[model samples]
Target: MTQHRIRNKNLGLAELIAIALGGMVGGGIFTILGISVSMIGSLTPIAIVIGGLIAALAAYSYVKLGLYYRDEGATYSFFKKIYPNSHFSASAIGWFIIFGYISTLALYAYTFSSYAISSTDFANNIWIRKGIAIAVIGVFTLINIWSVNGMGKIEDLMVYTKLVVLTIISVVLMQHGTSSFGTFIDNMALDAEKSNIFSVLIVASLTFVAYEGFQLIINAVNEMTNPEKNIPRAIYSAISLAILIYVVISLGALFAIPTEEIIKNKEYALASGAGNVLGKLGTNLVILGAILATSSAISGTIFGASRQMSVIASDGYFPHWLAIRKNNSPQNAIVGMAVMASVLILIGGLELILEFGSITFLLVSLLMAVANFKIRDKTASSTFLTALSIVCLGIGAILILYYEFTTKWEQMMAIIILYLILAVGAWVYSKKNEMKGKSS
Candidate 1:
């Protein structure tokens, strides 16, 4: 009935950081590696760092509004309370954010499948990967529908374990990397000469998906103490750690594996290439790390996003059936969310899903910046930082749109049509709520 999980201030700063880091450092790095390398080559690290900065800027508004609102519903809840009279605006935000989660869900599962398929005999079988991705989504959907409270604890372990595994993978690859540090820099220098700033910026914009899960910290407001102190600390610390982790892993890969190999492998780049360079032991380590990273990412996304979906439904912005619950779980929303994600994996390729998710979150976070600006006084937000968030996030969205328009117009159009569909759905629900409000 409540917008958030039961209130319990048991999570400390360390736990808070883990939760935010867990939400973030998930499938993002795994999904973006090959694409970023392909687009920017040895300059991927620079683009990744820029992307991290962009995430930091977005976090400013979230932290400000989060502390002011102190509501666990987060993005949706913020908009709803802030624009209490604008049913359409609130409804649209809820719809956008929920679907945004769905896009990321598909990204994670697809990435998982890519890595899962890499070690198999049918590595090139697209249909088999799709099948595995859908099946994994189905499994998680059942666990959610069945209401497995214990999964949360397991998710925490996956988070910590994956971090260690990734670190080990990074170190191993760096140790056994075929290329020298000097060669790596020379390659980067060569890349810089060949590529323009726009290329790196575009890649940076695309990599924003890797930095998204930081907002999960606010969702735990009810479970953390000293909101004023812990919120910013946890979010900022987690983002910094994520940036470090990503930079290290990416640089290690660039040094250890060739650019063509990474680009060629695409989805399963790390695992596939690590075998040739780091041998069987190293390759297996990367696969295990990728699996844990993506698996937890998928589970966490479904759980958090489904809860938000249920809340949106309860508020009448989504299908009423999605509000149905069993054993305190949003069974209908869970199933509906799973079905949509599986459909996405079916139709869209990995890059399409990745770009769509990055764009959606960028747009949503930009909206949050605008909302924060409107209530700067109440939230005590810095006008300069808020404007920076708006400007930077707006540009990031534009850059992604620009890339898609020029190189992948078909995907661009698909994204636009999807938005059109979501907008109409959000509007219809908001309209229904208005009519019901007047009749009562």
Candidate 2:
């Protein structure tokens, strides 16, 4: 039987929210803060709000499509079922979404390791950090392979606990920061004058990846209870909470930490700033919060994305063996995802992974918006909102691409080459599935 056949509907509203929050809040603030602050300076919080709003727009289509189809495969399955005739489209979305998850998985783990090792003498050793990153991915993979319910409970603890730690960290930073509240406002005004609107928008677009995890809620449709009500409730609530946490913490980081310090210590920027502002005690707290955040995110991503991987594999877009499950979990797919993410951690630079993940999700989410717009009547979606989501998400994706082309053309070319490789893989697999159909 398919894994969906054994659904116990054990995931409730809280667990679902934890999963979504776990996915979104993971290492997002920790990594994005430095980059966003470097670009927009004191306007980082505003850019974060814009990014969160963009994510909300993306979530609208996901929620509508999710409820309409009730498919756990989510992005790929939604597109595939909506346009069943388009095997290549299904295959391509499957490849893109899975790899997107892989990139984020690597991102979170790398961030986790960066913080985990920051307090140690081995802080500057990249190899050790990467090794630890791979090791953490292995730990979460085993947790996910163990039990869905177990993972959910752990996620609840990690996500909720981190929220508290994070809030406290932000408050403490602000209270002890060199920059006063008035100074913060003045700096923001200064940044407004210095940074172009386009630069702020580009940073906002980059932050979209930080919000990519809410749709992860839909990936748990089979495991979740009351899909009709709980899906919308859990996802919307998670996104709202994420926005609040991101804004507060980002504002704290920007206020307390010098802009140059954050920019210079991009890998563990939050902790570095905490060290200078709040000293050892505060630095430890930030590191602990970051570790928890990234750990839960890694776990949540593995739990949600592996299911999609198996579904795609079952449909012949991936190796069929990955579809095989034990104890209602796609064990092989989980292992496959872990191995791949570890490989990425070993090779992928922080910036490259960040850019790859941001671009992939923005493009994929834009596709979801387009697909939702096509079936607005059936999904009960708002015409104006959906159209606006399309326009804004399109601009979000374009802004990132434009920024890369203008400044980082080589990186853009690398991303382009990666896309070409994925497209070719999709074609090959789709062809294999087609030939299998004929042979059978």
RMSD of each: 2.6, 1.6
What do the candidate models score in CA lDDT, each in turn? 0.82, 0.89
Best by lDDT: 2
Alpha-carbon runs more than 4 Å astray in model 2? 1-7
Q: What lDDT does model 1 reach?
A: 0.82
Q: Per-residue CA lDDT of candidate 2, range 1-440, in tens?
A: 55565556789999999999999998767667888888889998899999999998999999999999988899999899889888899999999889989999998999889889887899889999999999999999999988888999999999999999989988878888889999999998999999999999999998887888898899898888788999999988999999999898987787788888888876477777678877898889988998999999999999999999999999999999999998678999999999999998877676776777778899999999999999999999999999999999999989989988998999888888888999999999999988988899
Model 1 off-target regions past 4 Å?
Answer: 1-15, 122-128, 142-149, 223-226, 324-331, 346-351
Error of 1 at 299 (Å): 1.7
The 10-residue segment with the lowest total lDDT in model 2: 1-10
